[model samples]
Target chain A: MIELEGLTKHFGAKVAVDHLSFTVRPGVVTGFLGPNGAGKSTTMRMMLDLDNPTSGTVRIDGRHYRDLAEPLKYIGALLEASKAMHGGRSAYNNLLCLAQSNRIPASRVREVLDLVGLTAVARKKSKGFSLGMNQRLGIASALLGDPEILMFDEPVNGLDPEGIHWIRNLMKQLAAEGRTIFVSSHLMSEMALTADHLIVIGQGKLLADTSMADFIQENSRSYVRMRSPQRERVLDVLRAEGLAAVEAGSGVLEIDGATAEQIGELAARHQITLHELSAQRASLEEAFMQMTAASVEYHAHAAGEHKVPAKAPPGAPGAPGAPDQPGQPGQPAVQWGRSYEERRRRRSSRKGA
Target chain B: MASVPAVLQSEWTKVRTVSSTVWTLVSALVVTVAMSAGISALMKATFDELSELEQATFDPTFVSFSGMILGQLAMVVFGVLVVGTEYSSGMIRTSLAAVPQRATFLFSKMAVATALALAVGMVTSFLAFFAGQALLGEHRTTLGADNVLRAVIGGGLYMGLIALFSMGVATMLRSSILSLGILVPFFFLVSQILISVPKAKTVAQYFPDQAGSKIMQVVPDALGSDVAPYGPWGGLGIMCAWVAAALLGGYLVLKKRDA
Candidate 1:
């Protein structure tokens, strides 16, 4: 178990990590999610005692990292590959030094080499290894000690599809053996598939810490879509029945908190000919975009008509920023949330152009 | 706390595994011995060309070490590469993670590299002395001669000290290129050039190399070089001070800065 209590780090005038506290539990794959420059790398460095925190403490298995007799045997981390090993040394010698430091047996080095499928190139210098091969070497080193807690920072950054599949299974297999697995990534799609729980942060602050299912359900909106040539009649029926429908452009009406069957049945009762009727569930990717956008918006514009209390407070799911927000709804917060999403999309496309 | 022996063993592995360690130290020995032999031969052939004062107080032991001016640069490269490659290749993070105690990590690596350097330095000095004395003919000094053994031992110590000082400077600079860029010239060109520039020679004599080389001189004010304010050992002590300050600064930087 890895516990960070009020962990914080500041680089000069810039706050890299601001009072982060979370426990990574064993027996599950916990995914750490954050946007770019969100202090994920800095937090990992502190966990290894490579960087001294400005304040607070990190305990691995109930003791400080530096106090551990053999730190590699307690917690193994893969921070960066292709740059962490010496180019002049062979892949085998690179892991050899790290293994010898932690008092790990030399035989285990070969075992890990085979585990990562790098047995053939173990004698070759790391400088000649490709990105994929270097990543495998890094993973081999991380697993050399066979520690209980394994942390990988974006382990899938430069892998082929097969390599990606191999790592995904390896992480799940490790978690199945009851080892604590903590991995970080900017891609929510990967997290949605691999992570059992998520701890998300933005702008160096905790945003959400919850189960994967609950995170998507609480932050994302799933609704039904309807398209009818007699859209006016469907709207009239929906309004008469005290149901709200939003025109989602392109002659489609999106209705929240209602099933497609009910909407279809209501249209039939109103004798409306429908062109399309389907239920749309918001993806985890969209939920993440919205949640991260809300955090950025909170940092930029803390006050205005958009009420953070109504939308982000009640089921904030362990967010430290929730209780600090104003505790009343001055206006609907969904309007501004959608607007922020639009702006983010436009800004990204502009950068691409 | 980390196990000191385990860390020491790990550091030894790190030093021996890299090719730069062998290449740099071998060059230091080969270059020093070869250059010393050449200069000793030149001194023997030029006996008649020397002034009356030069021939009267000729220090053959010091002449045998004339090649140190160029050879010490290799020792500097060895020391710099030992510590600087960690920063350049980003291996420091991985190495630190394995052994998080910064002092233990830094000191252990230095201890291993310093031992290797000293061993090679001793061998180089012994070979250079034998080869140089053989080439110098009648002007040669034997190991049994008064103060000759100390001078020969001092030659080895001087080489080892140069490597150690380079290690300290490289630790503070944290880059092989930057450390080599400043150290190669400071030990070779800059200090050598200032030694002939009138008043500049006064201050230049206090430089680490100029002072540390005093230990290898058997004759008083050897080979007509200027008289130093301190004895041979005292000159070496001054160089030791510079090395300590550099290592302290490096440890502080490692402690306070983020990896």
Candidate 2:
């Protein structure tokens, strides 16, 4: 278990991390989510005591990191990739020095190398390894001591799909063994697949700390869209039942805050012939954007300004700020970091206009 | 607190595994021995051209280590790389994490690198002395002579101190390129050139290399150089002060700054 009590760090006058207080409990993988420059790396560094905290303290398994007899055995952290190893030395020898420092057995070096599938290149210089290979080596070094708490910062940055799948499974497997796993990334989609719990930060402030299921249920929106031959009768029935239904185009009535089962049963009682009663649920990606859009630190306003087109429907499917939308001037991912509250105000003004 | 011996063992492994350690230390020995032998042979052949002052205070013991002016640069490289590579390769974070006690990590690394340098420096000093003496022929001074053994041992101490001073500076600067950029030029050009200037010589005499070189001289004002206010051991003591200050500065920076 890692406990951070009011941890804060300041770089010059800028507050990089503001009073971040949370505990990463054992037996589950806790995903740390934030946009770029949101103090994830700084927080991790302080936890390891690599960078002294400007205020507060971090306790690893109820002891300060430095106070632990052998820190590597307690917590193994892979900060940044490739750059941490000695490029001049072979992979095996590079890990050997760290193992020897804490009096770990040399045999464990080979075991970790094999664990990361780098046994064949164990003697090869680390300078020659690819980015994917470098990440694997970093993981191997972190596992060298058989540490109880494992932390990885942006573990899948430059990996292939196969490597990404491998790491996701590895974290799950490690957490299954009752190890505390803390991983950080900007993508919620990745975390959705891997993280059991999430601790989110935005602009150096804690936004939410909750279970994955709760985070999704609270932040994500779901509504039922109904397509009926007699759309007016369906709307009349919904209005009589105190359910507000809007006429979506093409003879469809959309009801907010109602499940498909409830709408279907109501239409059946009303003798309304319904062609479609499908539920539209927001993706975890969209939910994450809504929660964190206001507190994003670095905003990339491509081409001088982002022109939110007037009279356009806001929050529509496939709108800007949606992920996996390629070939934009800048990545639309930045749009996801915009202030959701401010966007709503602009949207209301557009309606007035 | 970490066990000192275990940390020392880890540091020793770090120093020995790199190829730079072998190249730099070997060159410190080979270059000094070869260059000193050549210079001593030339001095012996040109004995007739020497002035009365030059012949009167030849000090073959001092002449034997002449190549140190060039050779100590290799020692500086050795020392700089020992500490500087940790920062350059970004391994300092990993290293400090393993042994979180700042003093233990820094001192253990230095202790390992310094011990290796002292050993190599001793071997280099002995070989340079013997090779230079062999070429000097009749002009050669024996180790049995008064002050000769002290000068030879001091020669070894001088090289080790040079490397130690470089390590301290490197740790303070925190980059191999930056330390080498400032250190190599200062030792190879600035310190050597200032020693030749009449007015600047006064301050140059107090420089680490200029004061430390006094340890290698067996005779007073050897080779017509001006007499220093301090004796040989006192001069070395001045150099030791510089090394100590640099190390203290390094430790403070390492302790206060983020990795």
Q: Clash number for every model?
A: 0, 0
Q: Write the per-residue lDDT of candidate 2 for residues A20-117, one digit (tens) a residue.
A: 99999999999999988889999999998989989999999888888876788888988898789889989999899999998899999999999999
Candidate 2 lDDT, B1-259, residue by residue in tens: 7778888988998998899999999999998988999999999999778888988989998998999999999999999999999999999999888899899999999999999999999999999999999999899999999999999999999999999999999999999999999999999999999999999999999999999999999997898898799999999999999999999999999999999
For residues B160-223, what per-residue lDDT tens digits would candidate 1 score against the true structure?
Answer: 8888888888888889999999999899899999987889999998888988888888887787
DockQ result, candidate 1: 0.82
Note the DockQ of each predicted structure. 0.82, 0.76
**TM-score of chain A, model 1?**
0.81
* Superposed Cα deviation of residue A337, candidate 1 (Å): 9.2
